[model samples]
Target: YEVNQNSGNENENGNGNRNDEATIHKSGNRRTLHTTRGCTNKEFLNCQPLNLKGTEGAVGLAHWFEKMEFVIHFSNCVVECQVMYATYTLLGDELTWWNSHVRTVGHEIAYEMTWKSLMKMMTEASCSRSKIKKLEIELWNLTVKARPKMLQKAMELANSLMDQKVRAYVARQADNKRRMDNNPKDNYVHPGRDNILTVTLSRKEQRKLLRVEPWT
Candidate 1:
């Protein structure tokens, strides 16, 4: 009877040991998962994007938007979180406008808004027609200033091409002269045997030759 009881006690102890090992494994996995979450949270905070104020003109707004998008992409934020993080960085007039917008739209709809829609609303509210016109005029002036350089480069390319064509024409003429020098009998096919044509025909004579005169 004592031997039987001892064997049963050993079986219970073995089962408890296995349960403890499984519990420890589950806890370790949970800790690792939590640590990973904490690390990502730190990363998101470290990579926070630039802020915006409503008073910043078109150029400043454009710069902020570019930086913001870069940070958002690096941070790997989802659509809903993107709006929250972007609006969190707003200051001064921009914050005031955001609050007004939220009050008008209500909390549920405002919080659910996409990042793109928020940007569009902000642009419409912030960038006035005068600022847009100013930006356009500046861009046009830059284009105008760049025109002379572009034209000069184009002219240089065209001149280089013309020079190449001229060089090719001169080389062909030289080759013809060399061939004539090598084969002197080729010139005997001229109008008369006594008339030794010294050089190529002029453009005027060539044109005249092309024109068929009526028989007198």
Candidate 2:
């Protein structure tokens, strides 16, 4: 497949600066970036191929467009090279259609065509307006049906979290009470049951408990 600047003025103007940077050329599954013609100073080992056949429908076309855009950005593909490389990835019927399109439009006109124009043409060819509208309606219906359940699930999760926090607080308070009970400082006589004793023991009681006799 051949891509020409026939698409738009934007590509031509962009080519002035972009071409100065790098041009990505595919070699097998990998792509290499060349700053100058016939130079292979930098290589990208992880570059994936952008193979898109015409039969993929609207969803597939959107996926392919996303992938192509990612590849273009990742490879830093120049404007002309972007159109050329992306078109080259088209397979089977898509390739045939593009070739026929190029021939009908003439190479000079097709060569000047921008990437945006090609995308518009491809989208129109792959998806009909009625089909797109049907898809939108289906998506809207699905979302509406699922929204209430989703909200209910969210509320249940929030209430569960609050219950866990409450339990944790109660457990912490219980643990603190246990610790206080085990401490000797908290072993005071109960004022309601025992003889009148303030929160603290008298000095005599303290000495008696320690088994130390008071001096005269």
Candidate 3:
């Protein structure tokens, strides 16, 4: 009976040791598993989450980050290259970078990021338009102090949004030209009138003209 008890005790200890080993192995695997190659400093800054509102917002941002990580990991070569280009645009100087690199990967992503950043900066200003203007002036002053050339490009982007009238006018002109180009030929009339005009009408026009009755 004592021998049987000892065997049972040894069996229990063996099982416990196996379980511990398994646990350690599982933890090691988790630690070693990385979703993607590490992000660069600029990429990290570009992909950083905004200040979220609540737990729900935080979760949403976490999910977005995970999705971005997955893309970085498993996306095709083209998509990965695009993600890199988008990262550069968000954190780097657009004009200088644009001049340096001809390929714009994920252009839509860069556009959306640029717009969102500008909107956030605009919203942080005081409520009044005058206050917002003053804030922009102060921002420009600080930017110029740091690096004048960089600030010039930044100001150009800001001013592009500020000059809405020019954009509106250019859009209207383009729209008008497009409409004229697309106008249907079937809707228009021939220039000269059949009866009232001094020039003689063609046979087809004369026949149609004859069919019309004068007012009694």
Candidate 4:
């Protein structure tokens, strides 16, 4: 009996290999290129590769992966290389700082893997809107965890955002107050029992108070 070479599982050229690599010629040399670029550098830094060994190392790797996944998902975009590098570099230094201080506090050396810690790492970099939204979502999710430490960290972040918003609001309110103060009234009235009280200050006086251009 003759063997049929054109089996359905075989390639057109009759190669029985299931995994086929693509070949490209560059500089007159044949080279094989993988289908995907694999994990990004940020991903590698954040997560351990599949080949990583040992349970302890694996745990640390998993921690990094979780923290980074939170950050990336919160930010809603692949962090730019420069920002990622800077943030991770800061995190490395912060880890060193925490380790150095841990001994003095009588606490064992613990990894500084917190959202606030990560935010501190990225302080020098401005996060995008998507990232901020993502962070908020992550914080909301963590609220259900109900751990005191996580809740405290979330509160701290919330307070920081609130403080910034309050400052902006106050500044806008002051601007509006100043605008109103500088506005000139065409008519004036005096206060009585059930009457209105309107004090017409001179343009110069108003300008002195509001620090705005006086109406001529």
Candidate 5:
């Protein structure tokens, strides 16, 4: 289906496939929707809201997610290679820092980051708005600069929590595989080249944060 989108006219081709095109026009008393080669998603999201009647669909964010998950349950190195192991592990480390600061006493870590709601914000929502994505990056940069002084305590908590989360996730995957192996007749979706399963340090960390993660 191909829709002019601008004129609210719908056009369709014989075969069932989408032939969509989006455009933006501003200034002058004229309007046009053009498919240009230099357009980018960031630019698309940054566009201002249009008061035009049919322009909303053209400039609006497609509030949808790729239902596919990226985590694979195999022991093979292929699955491991696809994931951003160091980066994601580092994120877990940060979460660990927060947990320890709250629980530990005399050896308490008092990192004063204003983004305590960060993890929760990510877990609860996923939107196509560019502003939110930009805000997240801004918050992260702030956190880096506002990091706590007690490096030893921070590292200790981070590493411990990260390891536990990874191990537990792997164990769950292995158990699921064993169940599928035993019940051959049961329908099971095996990890494949096209399959995408999301993975993270515990369920808390898995989110559609800033775009899809490397592995996903």
Candidate 6:
């Protein structure tokens, strides 16, 4: 009977040891899971996008553009790349990036207009050669972040817009020069001005343009 009691005690001890091993294993897994969650949270903070509120008003759109300058310069998310492409389409569709206030009752209305005003301003202000150089450095750092696949695409979009703005600016400058040369003595000013920047209609147009996937 003493031997039988000893054998039972040994088996009970073995079972208790197994349970303890399992508990430790579970705790280790929990720690690993917690560590993973912490890393993911950091990624979220690093890659999170800013919400742009100014679509119609120049002040609002200006703020939105300011947010984008930081975001695009440092963001590597595929979705964020699409955000810039989305902006291009937004400016293209309206052909007028500024608010109606830009076309005050005093200014002469023209037959056809385009997005040069606002596009030129943004490209000149934030996308200047100096700023572009700084952005290039930031973009390189961003490419090493998560979702690296879209980094090149984001750069492409920005470059394309900059190219477009440059072409438009040159054309406008030439036109201005031609006008001045034609009437050196008139001291004439053009009836309607160019270069306004504003976006309206919320993000609906941007979403629709991106949906078309014109860049693809």
Query: In candidate 3, what are the lDDT values of residues 109-194, reduced to their tens digit?
Result: 44444423433432332134346556999998987787977778899988987798788999999998788779866457666553
Q: Report clash pairs, candidate 5.
A: 69-196, 69-197, 69-198, 70-196, 70-197, 70-198, 71-197
Question: Which of 1 and 5 is the better model by lDDT?
Answer: 1
Q: Measured by TM-score, how close is model 6 to the native structure?
A: 0.20
Q: Judged by lDDT relative to the true structure, which candidate is superior, 3 or 4?
A: 4
The residue-by-residue lDDT of candidate 1 on 1-216, one tens digit each, is 122222244223434531111111134324211111112444656886677876668788888888878877888665657777778889998898889889998988997988788778877877664476689999999999999999999999999999999999999999999999999798666466334443334544765888855458
Cα lDDT, all candidates: 0.70, 0.71, 0.45, 0.47, 0.40, 0.45
What is candidate 2's lDDT per residue for 1-216, written digit by digit as tens? Answer: 333232343233434544345455776666555453221113211467558877677787889889878876776655666666778778987898889988898877876778788899888877664486679999999999999999999999999999999999999999999998899687775666555444236766778789888788
1-216: candidate 4 lDDT, tens digit per residue: 222223432223336444333333344344333221233555545642222111223345455445555544543323333233323433443445434545665442223334445445333222333366579889988876768887798999999999999999999999987877787552333346223222344555777888997558
What is candidate 2's CA lDDT for residue 28? Answer: 67
Kindly give the stretch of ten consecutive residues in candidate 3 with the minimal lDDT sum: 17-26
Q: Could you give candidate 5's per-residue lDDT for residues 1-216 as a string of tens digits? A: 232342453332335433354455654655555542332323322332111121122122121111101121121112222122211222333345334544663222222222223323322332332456679889998888767655767999999999999999999999999998899877555666224333334333544454445564
Runs in model 4 deviating more than 4 A are: 1-146, 186-216
Pairs in steric clash, model 3? none
For residues 40-102, what per-residue lDDT tens digits would candidate 6 score against the true structure? 223434655444323344454566556555544454323323333324323421335323423
All candidates: TM-score: 0.41, 0.40, 0.15, 0.20, 0.19, 0.20
* True-structure lDDT of candidate 5: 0.40
lDDT of 4: 0.47
After aligning candidate 4 to the native by TM-score, how far in Å is the CA of 187 from where it should be?
9.2
Flag regions of model 6 displaced more than 4 Å: 1-146, 187-216
- Index of the highest-lDDT prediction: 2
Q: Output the lDDT of residue 174, model 1.
A: 100
Residue 124's lDDT within candidate 4 is 25
